[model samples]
Target: MIDRVPAQFRGVADGVVAVAAADPRFLAVIVNGSVANGQPDEWSDLDLVVVCADPYRSEVVAQGKDFAAAAGPLLVAFTGEHVGEPRLLIALYGPPVIHVDLKFMGLGDLGERVEDGLVLWQRHDSVQQQLDATSAAWPQPDAQWIEDRFWVWIHYVAAKIGRGELFEAVDGLGMIRSAALVPSIVARRTDRPTGVRRIEQLAPEMVPALARTVAMPDRADCLRALRAAVELYVEVRGDDVVQQTEAEKAVLGYLDGFPA
Candidate 1:
């Protein structure tokens, strides 16, 4: 299984596996993301799911930095609280620096996964059995959910632009790209709504339009980018999804007031 990892990452991967196997508290280590899927490239980070004994979950999480440091020269490490998963320790390692994500969890957490990771090492068949019992389901975007918030978000972006807060306006534009447009565009082909992940490969035809949504710091350019985002959203959001008509009308009118 270590051979499946890219050449650059194999050493670190093997080191981590061996470290986890030697520890009684750590139950298993599963590799997920691009590396597990056999599609790793230079930019891909090592994503490891470290399953520990239920009783040791808290202790293991607390000592996450120590555990990760055992695998390599950990440059800096921190829990992924910002991304909502405190169990995850994101670390950078090396003279030849590499990014690694170690998501510490118990065997109980295996069933609720988005993808089936390759189990690099495990104490028993319990991990495999738990994975086999349930199918992986990546989250899909809800059209209604996006629709409900889209207009309000558009208004917010417009407000930032109107107030001459170009940075805020640009950030708002990014939110639209990642939250609304990227998913809608990616969903057209993969049915999986990834937020700007390999979007060029998935939907190259839409890249130019998507590129237009990125704004410069200037006022007119920001408004232009926002308009591009709004247009792109309308184009991608399918007809079947109900539109928020009054809000859309109000927001569009407000946006039109801005001189691009």
Candidate 2:
């Protein structure tokens, strides 16, 4: 599997293995994301899960920069706190730049993961054993959960449009696409409802509607995109979901008051 790693990333992956192999604290260095997902290309980023002994995980994460620097010519590195993952060290490496995410986790933490990773380097077979013992499951979007919030969000965006806050209105539409429609659309093509990821490849039929959601910060354009978003959401939201009829009616009526 290591051989399948793209040429541009091979060096960094090899460097990580070489460094991790010698480190007693690190139990395993597993590669995930596009590489492990079996769809890696030249543009793919190297995502790694560096398993450290439970006692040392904090220290290892604290000094993640040092470990990343040892593995490659790290140009810039930052903890993934902004993304709500403090354990992740997002790094950029090279004269030929490549992005890598090094997530330092305790050995026990491997029990819960979104997907299986390729065991690049391990101190023993324990890593594989743990992986075999547990299943990797990505969380699916709950239709009902989206349904409850959908009308509320639509009303919020409508208000923004009415107030002539085109910038906020445009951004709100993008959020709707990502949070509601994109996942709903992607779900139709693949079991994995990855928001907007590879939408063209995964759900080509929805491309025209998806494109219509993109507005140029103009009031009329935002209103049009908002209408498109509503229609698309209704189309993709499966028959099983409960309809928020009254709320939908109120929101649509409110939005109708807006001048195109």
Candidate 3:
């Protein structure tokens, strides 16, 4: 994965890592994601985690782009919409147009997020020991969590149908898919996938269902997709027949509003 990165990228990563490794504020420097796994490609994003020591943790996160600019020519930087990680700095680098993601994480917050990272540098044995003590496992989304959201999400789609917002209705399907459906599918397997980031690779079988879940603007097709999503979520996630029945009834009621 690391090998697949462009040569310029190598230099950039090296520079960034070197800068962070030397900083007293940062305790460790590690590379992970596709690059660390040795499967990087032209489109692969650079994921670098900078373990900030206690004193400078807040300062580092608040100064996201400021710190990232030290590594190279960062044209622009923004905070990523990362679901779990908050201190993420999504940066665009140039002359050559490279994308680098820098996360300023603290020791207490790292948790299971640093499992497979190849440590480029560490402050000392003490730092390594601290890293080792923290779990490398990501917590899985559980049943109650998905169940809580699934019912409301089904209603969201139904309300969209009532409003004749086919575009919004179709888009609402994705909310259910990512939040509930994908997690349900992943939980059925033995692997410890954090989320559906690699759903295509992790569960290719479900891709077609995603296509089927997208509905046409017409009422019949919208209802059909609603049914498909409900059935799939129920099938993969175990039947909450009560919720399913309620959703079915509500969708049917909405569909009846269309002229026969």
Candidate 4:
């Protein structure tokens, strides 16, 4: 599979796979994202999940630096922000400076992760069924999931606005987009809910316009973007949001209570 992608990424993949295959602490290693499901291209990062037995989970995760060293000369390493699972080491390697993400998890919990993951190595056959039946498809956001969160998120942002906290408001807006709006917009499509990353390539029809929703800390600008986000959500989702009308209206009216 490394041969399919650009030359720069192949060495990184080669090294990681070699190191992972030789590690006794791990039960299996899975390759996910583009390499797992899509055709190769120039830009791609290696997304690997290292499935460890419960006894070795913590010790293995602590060896992230060693993993990086094994991948190649480590340039820099850091823990990534929690999207959901808080178990991953993010690193960049020098000379080529390729990005590598190493997610560590126990063997039992491996089946719960829903993504298109192609198991590169499996030390034991107990979880063979798990890999063969991986949920690997990108699921569309359920309308109920959005409805439950959207109204509350509006209030969360409104509170940030009320407190005069522009930075939190900005970050809150991004969370709502990534969590609710973008996924629904590109539902049934191959697009990932990656905030505004590669918007032109992934969500061209919807996100280019949504980019205008970003705003300054000022009340009027934040409210302006907030309103735009609502309009886009409704336009894309329609009847799915009808139940949210009264709650949304309550907040829409509540926005006026803030200084503008």
lDDT score, residue 220, model 3? 72
lDDT of each: 0.88, 0.87, 0.75, 0.73
- Comparing 2 and 4 by TM-score, which wins? 2
Global CA lDDT of candidate 2, please? 0.87
Candidate 3 — what's its lDDT?
Answer: 0.75
In candidate 2, stretches whose alpha carbon ends up further than 4 angstroms from where it belongs are none
Q: Each candidate's TM vs. the true structure?
A: 0.96, 0.95, 0.83, 0.80
lDDT of 1: 0.88
Report the error of model 3 at residue 89, Å. Answer: 0.4
What does candidate 2 score in Cα RMSD to the true structure?
1.4
Model with the higher TM-score, candidate 3 or 4: 3
lDDT of 4 by residue, 133-163 (tens): 5644444467777886687898889889778
Error of 3 at 157 (Å): 0.9
Evaluated with TM-score, which candidate comes out highest?
A: 1
lDDT of 1 by residue, 203-250 (tens): 899999999999998888988888888999999986678889999999
